[model samples]
Target: MINNLFSAVSAAAAQEHFDELLRRPGLRIERIVSQGQASPTGFWYDQPQGEWVVLLSGSAGLRLAHEPSERVLSPGDFVEIPAHCRHRVEWTDTSAPTVWLAVHFDAV
Candidate 1:
């Protein structure tokens, strides 16, 4: 039995990405801690593996690719990203801290 779990601990609470988070075979996990700011303009995430994003604080807006609508997220909100679905972070809380927990894994 594995009794230990590796946790991603962030020292600063601000907007960031997973570019330097971690890497392993078929899996990646990231902790995003943010405060006040919309996502980068017109930038989207194209993932090869299915992704799951959970909001731990504040709020956000997600615009899915090819979709004409945007979804709102707040504390305790969780979303699943299917492989190959292009998506973008439209906006986020501009007055408070927003934290996110992202989990990635390959489909079997």
Candidate 2:
């Protein structure tokens, strides 16, 4: 069950790619690759589970519903999004693919 995280980068469009790296009871891990894609306008992610994510490469912009300013992320930047927090991806680096590792689990 060994695989490279950067493998299989699609070049067809500016679509984000998500790969489920691991799934177990109460936990899930994913590898996300983004290239100039972002959440749809007026769209927000309200998840029941908390998520911790880190940018492994490239850059990105994130904004929480309650936050007035957007946070730009670079390589090695990480953030914790609590359960029920509304957030969205504002942008990702278009010059290169942005790689992210995310872990989702029950908060309680």
Candidate 3:
């Protein structure tokens, strides 16, 4: 089967959209679409699995709990988040939808 990652995106959505692409033992992949969305104040994500995410289109701001400043991400930018590493999405492009490809897997 063939799939297009850019298809079926809704920029007018009320919240960030997540689509699971594939799942296997100890691994999963998903696509995330964000448009002018951000993490709720005082909220952070601490996941049991490690994540490797890439910005496919548009832009965003991401912050790691241990970092002093947010990292500005543009298309093609990627980040590797270790398991249990707290992080948050600070902001996303308002004029266009931001596309992200995320792979989650058990940490070695």
Most TM-score-accurate candidate:
3
- Candidate 2 segments whose C-alpha is farther than 4 A from its true place: none
Compared with the true structure, model 2 gives a TM-score of 0.93
TM-score of each: 0.74, 0.93, 0.97
In model 3, the runs with Cα more than 4 Å from the true position are none
Would you give me the overall lDDT of model 2?
0.92
User: What tens digits encode model 3's per-residue C-alpha lDDT throughout 5-56?
Assistant: 9999877678999999999999999999999999999999999999999999
Tens digits of per-residue lDDT for model 1, 1-108: 442122443434454544335668988977675655565787788888898899987788888987899899988899999988889888777676567878898966
Clashing pairs in 2: none
The Cα local distance difference test for each model comes to 0.74, 0.92, 0.97
- How many residue pairs collide in each prediction? 1, 0, 0
TM-score ranking of the models: 3, 2, 1
Candidate 2 root-mean-square deviation in Å: 1.3
Model 2, C-alpha of 97: deviation from truth (Å)? 0.3
For model 1, the local distance difference test gives: 0.74
